[model samples]
Target: MNVRSQIKDYIAAQPEPKQKDLQELHGLILGIMPDCKLWFLDGKDESGRVVSNPNIGYGVQVIKYADGKNKDFYQIGMSANTTGISIYIMGIKDKKYLAEKFGKKIGQASVTGYCIKFRTLKNIDVGVLEDAMRYGIEQTRV
Candidate 1:
């Protein structure tokens, strides 16, 4: 169906605790970007093979490739993984900023260059996550 419907279905299909957690995160992201464009990726390639986990996306930005090609993509993305949830802050040029900036303050989360992952929201500081997302949006805005 539509992007919102697809996102709702995807979140609803998750198992308990994850379903609830995803919903909460979806709400939080919407609050942070109330007017942003919504996106849903089923993680299928052009041939429809499952290459990655499904993703929920917000906002839009241009992704530049090393080959000089550029693509329009979402600024922020979230997904439920086997062990935890993943939040991706796309379009950042630096690969070490997230870890260096919020590594120690984000609690038990893994803060990589463009991703923050944790087992649960309770295991990390939501405020720090919020801050990171805010910075991501500001930095990646089209």
Candidate 2:
């Protein structure tokens, strides 16, 4: 019904270890951004097709496009995927910064342009993840 409820439902729907990981991540994100605006995306497009996994979002960032368009989106987002979980740090201008800075330090996670993906929380360094998330939030600040 609401963003918080949708996020809880999404986490609860996960299976086993994933569920636990999602719960932990949810708590961790909130601890990092205590007063952030929460968001929930059902992974559906305008037509309601399941285009992606459900995402739990934190904070707010305004994205300005090259075509003079802009929209508000989450600064950080987490989603459960088939193989693992994805933590997205949106609004980073430099696409290669994430991989170059935290790719090796983040343990077994894959650090892409704006996403850190790993099979489980246990497989990655939580501290490094936190640092990356903090950097992302700072970079996207309005």
Candidate 3:
């Protein structure tokens, strides 16, 4: 199945995920972007090891950053755990931009020189996030 389908299936499989939370997040993405394609990364890095401590299924990917030939411009990933939901801005090269924009909440973001990690989706401004995502579609050139 495709990433978005996989995500839908995964979330549906969860017995007790707060329905409103799931719907709200899903709605946020759909509302902010109607055309993003999704992908699944299976929680393993290129080396084949789980990236999170407790293994949160897989990373949710959004392909809004794809190039003209349909190559991925960038991948945005997300996962939820006991702590909270994380918004992973996968593969960002511009730290200055992110830091300036998100520093107010994400604090000092740990950079992969690629991924920008947020502990909680609620911490940052949704509009700023949307703006960044839009920038990904426009200037990022991934």
Candidate lDDT (C-alpha), each: 0.93, 0.94, 0.51
Tens digit of lDDT per residue, candidate 3, span 22-114?
445666666655666555556677798988532122222334434544444334545555544555555456757655665565443343333
Query: How do the residues 9-72 of candidate 1 rate in per-residue lDDT, one tens digit apiece?
Result: 9999999898888999999999999999999999999999999999999999988889999998
For each candidate, how many residue pairs have backbone atoms clashing (under 3 Å)? 0, 0, 4
* lDDT leaderboard ranking: 2, 1, 3
Point to the candidate with the largest lDDT: 2
Model 1 misplacement above 4 A: 66-68
Which candidate do you rate higher for TM-score, 1 or 3?
1
Lowest summed-lDDT stretch of 10 residues in model 3?
53-62
Give residue 83's error in model 3 in angstroms.
1.9
The residue ranges of model 3 lying beyond 4 angstroms of the native Cα positions read 13-19, 45-74, 105-123
Give the range where candidate 1 is weakest over 10 consecutive residues by summed lDDT: 91-100
> In candidate 1, residue 53 scores what lDDT?
98
What is candidate 2's CA lDDT for residue 53?
Answer: 86
